[model samples]
Target: MLITISSLLNQTELAETRDALETVEWSDGAKTAGRTARNVKQNRQADLSGSRGQALHELLLRKISGHPVLQAAARPAKFSRLLISETADHGGYGDHTDNALMGRGAARIRTDLSFTLFLSEPARYEGGELVIDMPGYTQAVKPDAGDLVLYPSGTIHQVAPVTKGTRIACVGWLQSLIRDAACREILFDMENLRASLRASLPQGSRELLTLDKSIANLVRLWAET
Candidate 1:
């Protein structure tokens, strides 16, 4: 399911990250792209193995781990490294899907969902909308700073080139505990309904119990070991 979580980073945290990224060294983004994706990726990325990169990763992980909305939607089993990317000089990535598998050996993660945590304000950039092709429609997502959009890993997506100013974002992927997207979608909907029903109906109502049980069963059916 395609979803946008807002205020992922508080005002203070967002400002701190933006300040740090202003002077952070960046390398060619193509270095990490797959063979075909590399041809169209023209942005710059931070050295993900460096000290600054590690710090960014830790900070993001801590924040993500505590986000209830992200926890419900992503159900992340393992998260990949945070890639701080910037686009300027009319730079951006063309349509491409992320690698199915990331890392190696014991640290391997199967990408089930992809997320782009936008740090640049919408007004700061001219034309760098994140376009994701869904089943029958194309969604152009250009969230405000401190917001993030998450989509299925296999979706065909691309970043429109920046025309006027620089666009900065932290991109990453995660392997979800619930492998099936449809199943997770159902659980998410059920949980949301459960919350609403709890407030509208009595706590011990039969409707709540039935929905809560259904959610448990779906989680059991979809959750991966």
Candidate 2:
């Protein structure tokens, strides 16, 4: 499921972080890329172990991970550091999938979901669409600033080149509590229903109660921990 959630960061957060992102020093993106993936990787990423990079990681996790829509869709167990990537003239990431695992020992995480949070406005860049390859068609997404696109970790995807202006985004990987993609989709749908019904239906209404019960049961059955 390819899901795009808007306003993952509010204006205040975007305003603050955009400046931070602009000032941070970056490293070659190939530093984290695998052998095969490095061949096609041509962008740059923030050195996330630094002070400002750490701040961006914490900020994104607090805002995006806590979002209601993202929580419903991802059911995340752990999040990697928010990786800030930029593409300048003739720069872009070629088709590749994220790593199956990240971190070591106690912090090891299985990547079930991958996400890209746009930090720059679309108008600022020329051709930096997030091109995701689906079964029969390719989906190109160039969302507004503060919007995030989430997809399965194993999907074949690429970032198109930025010809005119630089393109910057915060990307991350997550481990979902529910590992099965189909089960996660069902839970996501049910969770959305639960949220909507809570507002429209009366408190403790039979309809609301029933839906809540279903959601709880599904989560209990599917959740990893």
Candidate 3:
């Protein structure tokens, strides 16, 4: 299930992240791409080992961890290292799926979902749309700065080449506790319904209690860990 979380980062946080990015050094992004994908990937990636890069990574993790909608939709169990990608001068990634697993040994994470957090404003770049090929249709995404797009990692997707200014985004993959995308979608819908009912119904309403029980039971049945 594909979902979008608008304004994942506040203005002040976005400004700070953009400022820090300006001072960090970047390297070839293909270095980390899968063997087949490396042939078509053309972009730059920030060195995460650098102080500024590490700080940005931490900030993003904190924000994502606290987001209620994201928590409900993703149910993330483990995450791969974040990638700060910059594309310009016709650079773009060709159609390819993310690796099934990332990291090694105890740190390994099975990628079930992928996300892109936009850092550059839409007006700051031309093209560079994140295009995903769905079963029956294709979707091209280009959200405003601070927005995010989350989709299944197995989808065939690509970054359309940037024709004008630079495009910067934070990309990552995660292993969901609820491994089935359909199950995750159902849970997300239930969570939204529960929240709405909670706001309108009295505390401990029977309908709300029933929904809570069903959701909990479903999670218990579907959750991996």
Candidate number achieving the greatest TM-score relative to the actual structure: 3
TM-score of each: 0.94, 0.96, 0.98
State the displacement of the C-alpha of residue 55, model 1, in Å, after optimal TM-score superposition: 2.3
Q: RMSD of candidate 3 to the true fold?
A: 0.8
lDDT of 1 by residue, 139-203 (tens): 99999999989899999999999998999998989999999898888778877888788889988
Poorly placed runs, candidate 1 (over 4 Å) = 48-50
- Per-residue alpha-carbon lDDT of candidate 2 for residues 22-74, written as tens digits (9 for 90 to 100): 77788899888888899999999887677887887788889888988889999
Give the least accurate 10-residue stretch of model 1, judged by summed lDDT.
47-56
lDDT of 2 at 65: 87
Give lDDT per model, in order.
0.88, 0.89, 0.93
Steric overlap count per candidate: 0, 0, 0
Error of 1 at 127 (Å): 0.8
